[model samples]
Target: MTNKLISLLDYENKAKQLLPKDTWQFISGGALDETTVLRNRLAINQRLLQPKRFQHAGFVDVSTKVLGSIIQLPVMISPAGSQSLAHDQAEEATASASSRVSTVMVVGTAASRKLETVRKVSNGLLWFQLYHHGTALTEMLIRRAEIAGYQALCVTVDVPYTITAEKDLRNHWKLPYGTEMANFTCDEAGLGIKSNTADARQYRRPPHVPVTWDTLEWIRSLTTLPIVIKGIMRADDAVGCVERGVQGVIVSNHGGRQLDGQASTIEVLPEIVRAVGQKCEVFVDGGFRRGIDVLKAVALGAKAVLIARPVFHGLAVAGDVGVEHVLTILRNELYEAMALCGVNTLAEVDRDLIYNCPSTAPL
Candidate 1:
């Protein structure tokens, strides 16, 4: 079954056909205008892999460690909310497939399945993502994840507002009945969100709360888990995370669903990586649909890459089987790219393996 998927786009096409209209938009649509969404892919395609020929590179080893946890490949599943929209099995199926491939699955705060439930089913690394709904809710999730034995905490910092996607508005999309924010569905969780802070009111839509740097520090005080900040696009933010003792920083634009017209994650990764230096591990996501894209990110100094929509595409198409197939395809492609670039190990993959190659027609 895995052999049937020769590329990530195949999974996407199948997913589009299999999923309901509303569910598809929720997964595929970006923020207003979607310029940043398209820009993410364009920035990636513009970078060319400068493969080295006849260097006699041997067997490629794609395995690498993320904050001391070794994964089979440099690819990991990014956090996506309510995966139940993609498959009946939901996050459980995705977790099982991620474990089967020996990689990490950063469970979303809005996952349809509870974190513990997903953890119970996964034999692989699990990291819980948080949206900083508020002090109590944030603490509750951190404590629960710690109790459940999650390895790390990834705090999403970009979505200071709930900018409803344009496609969702057009389709009048809503979560199907029965699916819930498994972590916060209970009343005891306190609605799982708060109004945006005063400073962020201008940037946020109604009912969306902003988590400030002070809030980040507050979060850091509550748990001993290694905290990684997601949704960062600026070099200064990366530097600040390092200075404040963050364990990692994920260079992302919230998959272009938070801010429209912001620079793509790929476009800003190099600067952030250079700014952060070796103070902390740097990861990236957005517009990563191929093994070559993975290689391009690695060469630009990303420790590893996280993918959200592609995993959702696979889940919608063929459940766990599609997910495993998608991961395997990317791994195989990364292996091939490494061999062609005269690199036998992840360490050998650096800026030297890439060059600027402009593209005219990105669509």
Candidate 2:
């Protein structure tokens, strides 16, 4: 009999072997030195866990509510684009898998499936991740996303300029033939994009307008889907979201994709949480691959956490089923970690369960 495959780390190893070198690099590479990429997870591991061995494990309840919706776990899928590179099922498969695990799916603007198709495919709650392409394209996408039944619109505000990963550049990675861009018309995306990516056959990050605090209102005007502003690394920005009346803030640095040397998402989570801990719900993601990491974020006051690359690895190996397994693995891990830490319910997790490590000391 074949041994059980219960861990996402096992799936990650399998995915690396199955995917092409270029695609693998694009999925994993961070900008420049990638110091922050390693820092993201390492920082989380630096956190010390004190076990209360005598406490009763009791009923393990990891369920938490985000943007007023309760989820089985604090983890959710971050919007990853170009699923065609990992598997043929693309966003449709991801949507189905996220639902299977009962976690919210954050669909990307660059998804291979059209916004409508992803909505149809999703079996659970959904959120649409937006790229600031220009007001017209942005508005149209928002309107369609609302019609498609997404619960929230996550505006990714960090990547104004593109970072061409050296691996994707060296590999000359290109999409397979017959891939389609379902959201926009063929004529709208004219060829002369500043982004150097050669594989972008039809689209690139929108160049017309970059996002600013002022841009939030324009997006608000488009639809009622609660806006979740992602890519915030500072406490001031977290506070800004509360002022803007946005529903949520993702404490992220684009998984260290945009600014290579910035603080790991874990390092900034506490500050952001402290800033708006009372004003709004804060979700954090970066270097968070373990159950302890989710607890760390919740202890620091995050309402939820997002896992970006691991989901891709799972998909590359087994499509929707793979992601489902990954989420379940994390859910189980969080349960065990919580029980070990002497807590059960999500609300029971607080600052007493966490402490900042001095390894984060000046280095």
Best-fitting candidate, scored by TM-score: 1
| Model 2 stretches astray by more than 4 angstroms | 1-4, 53-57, 177-180, 185-200, 204-208, 356-359
Taking all chains together, each candidate's TM-score versus the true structure is: 0.92, 0.91
lDDT against the true structure, per candidate, is: 0.85, 0.79
lDDT of 2 by residue, 240-314 (tens): 777888988998888877788888887788788878878777888886888888888788788889987888877
Model 1 steric clash pairs: 196-209
Q: Deviation in angstroms for 124 in model 1? A: 0.9
| CA displacement after TM-score superposition, residue 309 of candidate 2 (Å) | 1.2
Best candidate according to lDDT: 1
lDDT of 1 by residue, 192-287 (tens): 432233332321212435878788788888888999999888999888888777899999998889889898888888898889848899999998
